[model samples]
Structures are given as structure tokens and as C-alpha cells.
Target: MHDSVWKFVCLRDLQVPAPCQVAFKWIKLYGSLADGSHSYKIRNNEKHIDWMRIGAFFFDSPVAILSEKLSLPLTILNKDNVEKALESSGACVLSNIKRGIWIADLQLVRCPVCELDTCEGTMQTLEVRNIELFLCDEYQKGSWDYELIGSYTINKSVDAASGGIFDLKHIKDRAMAGVFNLKSWAGKPSDMQPKAMITFHSVAIRTNLQENQGLITKYYAMRAGFEGEVVSIRISQQLA
Candidate 1:
């Protein structure tokens, strides 16, 4: 099995507004499922209750998404070539046209170390104390799976000197300072025209927390909107 690590950003700190409502869609492509017929399916499900937080990072890579759903083994296919084939088919081509946060009503819970009240109806918010980067590895000889490898947290006094507002630039810069090897992992490939691909969307929130705690706390406390796209792609040399 091959392992690959990826870096992700929370973009801006997020918070739960009212009733939590975060959603995700999973799309799968079946290439000639033993009948020489092509088919695809889309699933819209709510995010896990424990994951609905402001500063949580998730696996948003295309390789991770494709590896998680495909059941039957198929030959490796290039993404660019797949797109060209769909365009030539004359059918309606669907792709990720819009990026960035679409919704922001994700629910959040306090850290276990903190002595926050659970019964209080007051809105609870949490900051990303440390980001646990996800590592994707090949599983079951053909499928891809993910796990947490390591994490990095910002030092409020060292990183943010001025201490007025948490700098988004500084946070991202620190998060991506290290290098990761992408050549060790495999990518999606198909023998037939792929019917679907996965796309990731983000959601930002405004919180009512305080700013004097620390870097993460202050950042989430201050109501500021930041926007950027954090995406990466890796192709496999081997074929199925």
C-alpha cells in the first residue's frame, strides 16, 4: 500500500449560526459494470455531527474522493482525457463551476479540555487549535483510504505579533511550509469514459466568541470573511 499526505486550510474560522445544516454530495461513476453499460449516482448527505466545526479541515482531494467510492477495479484514466471525452459526446457536461464556501450553518462543539457549559442554550464556538493533516493510503489492494498523520498549530504570541486580528495569510503560510510527497499514491483511471467526478465546496461562518484567548480564539472571535481555493491533484503511473 502507498501513503500520501495532503495539506488543507480552514479558510476562515467558521461558527454555528442557529440550527446546524451542513451538507455534502458524493458522486460515483460505474464504468461498464460487467454489462458494458455506463452509469453514475449522486448522494447528498449531512456531515457527521462531530465534524460540524468552524476550524476543521477535511479531505477534499479528488484522488481521495474517487478512491473512496469505486467498487470494481478499472484501468487508470487521465482526468483531462475524461473531460475531453465528455465534451465530445455532445451530452450536457457537468463540472465544478463554482468554488468557495456555499453554506455556513455547521454545528460546533467545545474542546474536551475546555470547561464550557453544555446545557446552556448560548451559541458554542471553537477555534482550530491545531490542524491534523489527513494522509490518504491505498487500501484493499485497489481502494484508497485516509487517516490523520500530524498536526500544526499557530502560536498566538509568536505568529501574530500585532495581535489586532488573526492574519489569514500567516495561518496558510505556516500550514503549507512543509513539503509532502504526492508520487507515492495512486489516482483514478478508467477503461471507459468516466461518467462523473467529485467536487468539493466550502462554508464560512460568523461567530460570537471573544478575541483575547489566543490566535485561534481571536481569529474566530473577530468576524472577518476570507476566500481562497486549496486544491491539489496527483496522477498514478500504474494502470488497473
Candidate 2:
């Protein structure tokens, strides 16, 4: 993966470019459970909606404020059960997480694969199932807003049954209007690998920034006066 591409995506999305035109000092990762309570709550806690678990693969960031009351839907396997769980329990009120950092746009995709991991050829498949838009500017310190401009999804599984996370920048970019796509030069598929299961949680923003910290940093990643520029913005594991 070329560092320039990664930097470009990060900078472009934030509407800033590097002085040297080189994207540096940024890292990308697959959004996953943090283990312990975080993961456990989503799986076991039938009474909560963990919006944070949602992926951040966007083709384009919102150029305009799409919605004032960010209300994105989470794709749950047991829609009714999950809804019931949240209605009955308050232990995991995902909606309580800080909005500024905790807010993210979610897109759900399905990749069905063979149960056996011993399959031949590529054991990965992908497809876009749902496209959701979210906004959390109210939950943040300053006026923040982003929207799902466009998105795309491709099924590239040699084996129809080979399961994989259909999570990638290509799909995100297509879904978010090129706002978020994997750095093509990175030599990595823009899609996310599949997981056995997944869930999402949304937390409300607290007045205190520090209390609701670590939700989202990309917001600060780009600013007119910031050191670096947002050369390119494709939502994925990095911003998820």
C-alpha cells in the first residue's frame, strides 16, 4: 500500500492537501470489536443498539448537512428481537454515547461463504445490502456534518459460499459518492472482510469533550488551519 494514497484519501475527504502532496502519518485499520464488554454487549445484550459497531465506509463525505437529527438505521439480524431488547433494557443505551466522536455513517453488506474454511481459491465474497446515512454535528463542539453522497458494492467471491466481510473502500466510495474508497495504490481491496456477526451502537454526546473522547478523530484530522490536508476521504475501517 502506498503511503501517498492513504494520505490522499484522508486529506481529500477533509478538503485539505499536504504541502508536499504526500499523505503521511496516517494509519488504516479494519473496524472491529474492542473485545470484553464492547463485543459482549452487542452479542449478549439483546436490549441495546450499538451504533458504534457500524462501519464507516463512505464513498463521499457530506458536502452539505443532510439531516439535523442524525438518525441512521442499524441492520440487525433479528430486527424485532434487537428492538425488543433495547426497549426492555437500558444497561446498554447505545444512543447515549457522545455524538461528535461516536457518530458514524453505517452501511450493511452480506457475504455468505462455506462453513468450512478449507475451501479452495479465494474464500471471500461481498455485496452491499443496505446504505445508511448519519449525522452528529450537534453532538460535537463545532458545526459538523456529513452525508452519504453515493456508494458501490461488488461480489468478488470465487466461491459463492466463501464468506467475507463485504467491507471495503470501493463499496464505501460507491455508496458514499467516492467520499471514501480504499487507496487504490494501497494494493488492498476497498472492501472489508466479513465477520461471523456484527452489531451497531449510537451514543449521545456529552457536553464535556473529554468524557466523550476517542469516538472520532478524523473530524480533527482535517481543518483549514490544521497541519495536514484532507487529500482524499473514503470512509472505511480507519474512520469506522
**TM-score, candidate number 2:** 0.18
Q: Local distance difference test, per candidate?
A: 0.20, 0.23
lDDT, candidate 1, 1-240, per-residue tens = 111110111232222111122122111101111122110111111211222322223332211111111111112122334434423432112222122222212333333233445532222222111111011112112232221211223343221111111111121232222111111111122212112111122112222222323322211211111221222111111000
lDDT of 1 at 85: 40
Candidate 1 clashes between residue pairs 3 or more apart in a chain or in different chains: 76-189, 77-189, 77-190, 101-202
Name model 2 segments beyond 4 Å from true.
1-22, 25-51, 59-62, 69-222, 226-240
lDDT tens digits by residue: candidate 2, 76-186: 213555434433431111111111112132222121133343433121111111111111122123332222222222223221111112121112223322121213211
**Which parts of model 1 have CA positions greater than 4 angstroms off?**
1-105, 114-150, 157-200, 205-209, 216-240
Compare the candidates by TM-score and give the number of the best one. Answer: 1
- The TM-score between candidate 1 and the true structure equals 0.20
Best by lDDT: 2
